[model samples]
Target chain A: MSSLEIKHLFGLRGVSKHDIRLILDHAKQFREILERPVKKVPSLRGMTVVNLFFENSTRTRTSFELAEKRLSADTVNFASSNSSVKKGETLVDTLRNIEAMKIDIVVVRHKGTGVPKFLADNSNAIIVNAGDGAHEHPTQALLDMLTIEEKLGTLEGKNVTIIGDIRHSRVARSNLWGMSTMGAHVTLCGPSTLVPRNTDLMNHVTWEPDIKKAVANADAIIALRLQKERMDDALLPSMREYRNTFGITDELLECAKDKVIIMHPGPINRGVELDSDIADGEHSVILDQVTNGVAVRMAVLFLLAGGRNNENA
Target chain B: MKMRKPSSSEFPIAVLKNAKFWNGKSFELRDEVRLTSGQNGDTIEYDCKGALVLPALFGFGLDFMEPLRDDVYTCADGVDAMLRGGFYGGLYESAANPIDDADKLTAAENRFSSFGCLGSSFDIKFLGAYSKGFGTDSLAEMMELAESDAVAGFGDGNGVIPHSRFLRLAMEYGKMTGKRFFFQPMDKTLRHSGCVHEGAYSDMLGMKGIPRIAETIAAYTVLETARFLQVPVHFKQVTCGETLELVRDARKKGMDVTCDVGLYHLLLDDSCLETLDSAYHILPPIRSAADRDALWQGVVDGTINAISVNHTPVLRQDTVVNFEDSVPGALSLEVALPAIWNKLVAKVGEARAIELLSTAPARLAGSTPVANNVVVFAPDKPHVVVESDFAGHVCNSPLLGAELPSSILAVYINGFWKEL
Candidate 1:
């Protein structure tokens, strides 16, 4: 694969299918490296990576930190809650300070949309958006893609229904772009309030408010976590209504193909977006998605840090 | 010692030779139009060949940050910006500092008079706040303000009065004073906290959506109230198709109502928001392509009375932030005239464009067009809009890099010719 020409992985909005395939190919190698006795690589040695998280996150942050360590790069963790950011230092000031430290890569998860793009435009370091405010979560999408491709062998012509609060899910947006680029027929299902009103603008994507129709004949079904705060905001009437309307149950899965894969980005609200039985069912690839996250992030960091210069040559 | 008045010899008659001006009806080419000498004695002549001269444009509902936030724009900068846009005069909606009472209104009038007395400047009529602090509770001292001769009208400056009852009362009271009430109709409840138009684009961008219902509902409410009060209410910055329909219906029913479309709305739609540039972020946010088409039709069909630059000049730093956090306005004055000519004249015709930009606005503001105060436009002269062209303090122009087809060759104000 030609060297990933992208300087920063902000979002998967305009990322090409060829580039996604290349990243997935590299991630497969990283997944193999995970099974080795010594799970460490000298590919990104001597480079410093900073995880600048303005928003709280456990899974994405840890996954990036582990990826940086596995690639043998020096890592710095900066959480806004404990850092000088609490003192009211502006985002640009804090980022300039970090850039002055000569970090090579900055993994940022900010609560503001377009924060990663802002940092990329202003700073010298490579930016990887961990997750921006309901905008894009490229790494999570890539890991989910890896899990999907692994189970289905290919994403081409596959029916992947992403059901839940898609309006506020950066993961759903990134996956929709990434998977749709790879020739998957993606369906977004939920209440009209949860689904974006402009899904018609997205190619190869359709809205299905009926969960059964969305899951019927699907090769994969990804249930998004319903944000409980949406209830208070009146986006959802109640959790009980949301579950009864759009939640994924075993019976819903039976509407799909015989071996349909079930995926969820972790920290799931068990009964809100998905039934407990369906979350723990045999079709569930939820844990595998978490396991693949490290490899996908490792591949992203490696490629962004000029991975194996000789390999490209 | 008393200063001697300048003699006629010292103040040469400034003549615009071979000029054509839109005479409130059609373009009439004339051999010469002479400007009588003023005290300044700075006189000049212009050979206006193949240029269409029209009444100096009157911009209605323009926001200038002066006396309160002078850092954004002062009266001088506002005048300079308006002159650059071919406007010799405009109504300044007192947005930065709410002119809510007789004292504040007089202060604003005095400030403008003093500033105008300084040098070659434009006439700036102030629009007083409709409600005290625009809080939608107490009515402003409209009678006192009118008696003080401080305001041409009452404006709510891009805000809905929130309470229709209060708005009705304000309009009813304003009716007694013979002052027009200008407002951008919006229901805060329907608007919620959304920034952009509620449609596919907002949904695609994941930004909160401010639905068209927010505007149409408020417009309907305001129209109903206007009908009940039998008072003329001027709606500023109408952005939606349904809002235009409402206005047309009201006008057809012989209701006392007038509405204006933003110049940007005539050319741009919500599709521009796809760029995520905050300059496109505006109140009564740009709607869909259908809405834009309807706005053009409204202008052409005479349903829309005027077009405004809606020039709300903000500091440069204020627009450089995130799309949501950035101030909602654009640096429009420097490019307003040329942009309108380039975008609208072809579809609406030159005569209609002049009526919308000059004649109609002047009539709305209760002013008449004087023959000497005119702008000469070289319609075929194409130039790209750039930051260097702006004399205003703010550089938040949405059309900063756009190539437009019309240029102001010369502008005649008072007895002087401003050549570009």
Candidate 2:
């Protein structure tokens, strides 16, 4: 397929496998372009893309901006802190004003779930969800998938385990949906208090309460950041207790396969979710995930903006 | 049918010919009937062939947002939706504008009363706030308002009353005054900002779950407190079947407790959340299918006493947001009767459904029946639920664009027969 079945990259829940394959294949081509001496592409030379971040983000925003710049698209950054959004302008009104500026694509990150779909419904521009409150981070998941595929050759029949704060991570949700679609087996490991309650989502994956057992058979283990506010919410006891229990340390890796890769959707709570060594070790592909993020995003932007692969260069 | 808006209290005395009604078991036909008025005002006669005549509905625990001065719809739109749905009277919640004092209460009552020119004196009553601005420190200045003409009952209009010492004192005060208090059973901490029922569906959708224990534990506490104090209480928006077991046991022991469920709760469930349609984002979020079925059983076995339309009118802009951010409630009054009829009345015969929708809620609201006030609904008259069909401004509704199997044809209130 030359194009995606879906017009908007809302989430991966209902995304077809064929569309995912197409995006991944194009991402591979983009990754090759990224390594070239002259990396910029003129595909979207005249098109304007707006980055509407209602919530604060570091890497995801920077990665998307870098990808937009690399694709030669005129990028406008709209941050909520200094924008009219803080002046009591509603989301729809702000979007209408942006659309009035003739923007071609809208990449939004909102604290509210399903905001991407909401923007897509209200405006004419193509929507890319950078992250939507605990709902999904589609591009992040796409990059994770691309990283896994690059290292392991294919996602089919691979065992991918995700640990810590499974209940609230948009990264885990998107990864589960996207990775599972590519025929990978997903195992969720976390404190019992943090597992998503009574969900059929558990039916699609195995739940291992023991961190060692969870990572034992994994081809890749993703350690999610443990937010400190969870202690105030009484979702956890303390960071020390969580680290001792479920954190990805070198000691915990002894039970895992030798080739088992380690990943984190970053700004990692180093000692809390992953040890420094585990995050930087030979098996660590954390930085690779960030690099693939730009390429995957380029593929997403190109696909949604209706740019063909080779024609984009 | 397009209705000619009537001035308040200017109802015409008319004779409805060949009207049919549900006599418990089936639809029974009646010959010419004279609907009279206290004042012999404008008299208009009309033939009501093939129409189901029933008492105008009195909704309980109903809510309409405080008028948004800049928005398209206002409090009058809510009144129009209720009247168009065949409701003559309803107990309005003071949620949007908290009623902590006599002034706010009187203002709210007067504001609702002003819409009387559009419909019959829409007997809108207000539930006094449980505490001062819903604070836990002290009870609201409702001791004086309780004796006033405007107070429907004592309860928090917007949220659940925390099980604090303040709640116990409020219960004692309610007991001393011999007034009914409404309890919205819930533990907020346990609810954890969940917007959907805690279950398989919420898990799959990655939305936070509102566990059933949040209602059950709070309900048990409320039930025990009311029983101990010998105070009469009513549970509003009871959504779980587990809570029903407690209510049934309490009633069996004659604890002087009663409960009502949202009209939409019986018809929908958490599975509907899969669509992520913000319209289905209701508070005390639609529970599991098992809970929906249990609610039906509660209705049949008389465990659930009445149905409230909970006719909340959120602005069109507020409802178009994401599922989690979208405000709860749908503009239900315009489509309530048809939805209830197609889902309930048609299958179980009209008497029981009418009792749940009209008679029971009226009794709960302590309304003395109006002799001539009646609704003429046409079950065979199919109509599409559209924005233009609403007497109010365009608003949010789950039933919009829906094809309902029935429609309300006209209403006779204050001796006037208004075709709708």
The model with the greatest DockQ is 2
Please give the interface root mean square deviation for model 1, in Å: 2.0
- CAPRI grade of model 1: medium
Q: Compared with the true structure, what per-residue lDDT tens digits does model 1 show for residues A252-299? A: 767888899999997999987888998898899998899799999999
Inter-residue clash pairs, candidate 1: none
The lDDT for every candidate, in the order shown, is 0.81, 0.82
TM of chain B, each:
0.92, 0.92
Deviation from native of the Cα of residue B374 in model 1, angstroms: 1.9
Q: Cα lDDT for residue B86, model 2?
A: 79
Using all chains and alpha carbons, the TM-scores for the candidates as numbered come to: 0.93, 0.93
**Candidate 2 residue-wise lDDT, B159-270, digit = tens:** 8767667778888776766778887788888887888898987776668889999999888888888888888888988898899999999988889888999878987888
On TM-score, the candidate that comes out on top is 2
Q: What is the lDDT of residue B186 in candidate 2?
A: 86
Grade the docking of candidate 2. Answer: medium
Q: Return the lDDT, model 2, position B262.
A: 89
Give the lDDT of residue B126 in candidate 2: 72
